[model samples]
Target chain A: MKVRVHVSLKNGVLDPQGRAIHHALEGLGFDGVNDVRAGRLIELDVADTIADEALDEMCRKLLANMVIENYRIEKVAA
Target chain B: MPFTAAVITFPGSNCDRDMAVAIEEISGGTVHRVWHGDAALPDGLDLIALPGGFSYGDYLRSGAMAARSPVMQAVVEQAGRGVPVLGVCNGFQVLTEAGLLPGALMRNAGIRFVCRDVKLKVENASSLFTSAYLPGQTITIPVAHHDGNYYADAETLDRLEGEGRVAFRYLEACNGSQRDIAGVLNEKGNVLGMMPHPERMIEPAHGGSDGRKLFESVLHGLNALA
Candidate 1:
């Protein structure tokens, strides 16, 4: 199985990188771009027997810092 | 009893030598250099230091990978048992990722790498690390990092303030840290994590020696407890 994790700063948390990109977009003459928040994508290759609980534990333990980030896991059948 | 300290060096840890030198010069103590791959810490360590540097090149996140390294497991265990731990800069990030400290370090609100001398106010002078400073005294220390802005929920922040767990606060707006928090201590007061490099300020030639008292306090505090 292959899993994908999308990790992003939690809502209401200040996203400096996102704000910088937003500024850059305006500098480039782009319009209507209200906001841009940056995030990361992590893909993992795991055995079929890997349980959902294990993946949750991975996110809670290491993949995502629960303090300011939230992680969403998606599994794709191989 | 002689002060025994260990400085854990992860890949890309540039400040390990500085941290070790600071501990040695200040306390005249034995400094042990431990590698991240080690499975266990040396027996009977009086202090464990996580120094500044872009550990693992700040991959994924600053100190994220290093916090999960093999030696960190032992570190977390030892810290739980009340062994004094001091984490500086990237080390502070690791402590948060390791769950030894609260909050997270995000990109600076200015979105630039801040590297210069900044004023800091000693908030808690009674902890093992800050006992040498007078409460509310302002000291000059240099901060160098991109992701040093601290963040925590309102409740936790309020509690940290109420309990005097906040060790240091930025006197000026250097980072967008919540409540200007630059340094904090663990619930047990044995672990300290701060963004500024106190080790860098031990010598007068470095501009100011305000940071020296932090190390001195910890050294004396530990010895006094012995």
Candidate 2:
């Protein structure tokens, strides 16, 4: 089994990198870009028998920082 | 008795020696160098410092890998026992990742690595780390890192401010830290995590010695306890 964790800064947290990207896009003459928030995607290849609780624990412990970021776990069949 | 301090060195810790030198100079004691792989800490440790650097090359996340090292387990236990722990720069990241401190340090708000002296307001002067300073006093310390922006939920921020857990706040806007927090103390006041390198500012040759007070404060607190 494979899992993908999408980690993102919570709403109201300032996203500096995302803001810079948004600025660059405007400089390139692109319009209608209201906002941009940056995040990370991590793919994990684990054993098939890993439980959901264990995966959630992994996210809570290492995959995402609960204080500032939230993580979503997506299981993809191999 | 001279203070007995330990400086934990992870593989990529570049500031461990600086931290040790500051502690030794301020406390007039020898600093024990502990490796990250060690499963136990030296007995009678008055203080344990996690120095700044790109631990584990900042892979996975800043301080993420080093936070899970064998030595950190011992550090956490020691912290729980009321031993003072100061985490600076990457060390701060490690503390938050290890669940020893609240909040996460994200990439700088400017998206560029910020390296310069930043003014910080001493919010709480009661912690072992900040006792030498006056409450609401402003001090200048150097901050150099890409991931120095601090973040926490609104409720956590309120709780920290209400409980007097916020140790330091940026006097000037430097990073995009929520509430302009440059440093914070744990609920017990024994553990502190901050992005500014107080160790770097301990020597006059390094520019200013304003940071010397932090080490002196911790040493004094520990001596009083002893």
* Per-candidate alpha-carbon RMSD to the true structure: 1.1, 1.5
Clashing pairs in 1: none
Model 2 spans > 4 angstroms off: none
In CAPRI terms, where does candidate 2 land? medium
What would the TM-scores of all predictions be?
Answer: 0.97, 0.95
Residue-level lDDT of model 1, residues A1-78, one tens digit each, is 999999999999999999999999999999999999999999999999999999999999888999999999999878
Query: Model 2, A35: alpha-carbon shift in Å?
Result: 2.2
Candidate 1 stretches with Cα past 4 Å from truth are none
Q: Can you write out model 2's per-residue Cα lDDT over A3-78, one digit (the tens) per residue?
A: 9999998887788889999999999999999999889999999999889999999999887877778899999888
Listed models, DockQ each: 0.87, 0.80
Question: What value does DockQ give for candidate 2?
Answer: 0.80
lDDT over C-alpha atoms for residue B62 of model 2: 96
Please give, for residues B38-64, the per-residue lDDT of candidate 1 as tens digits: 999998899999999999999989999
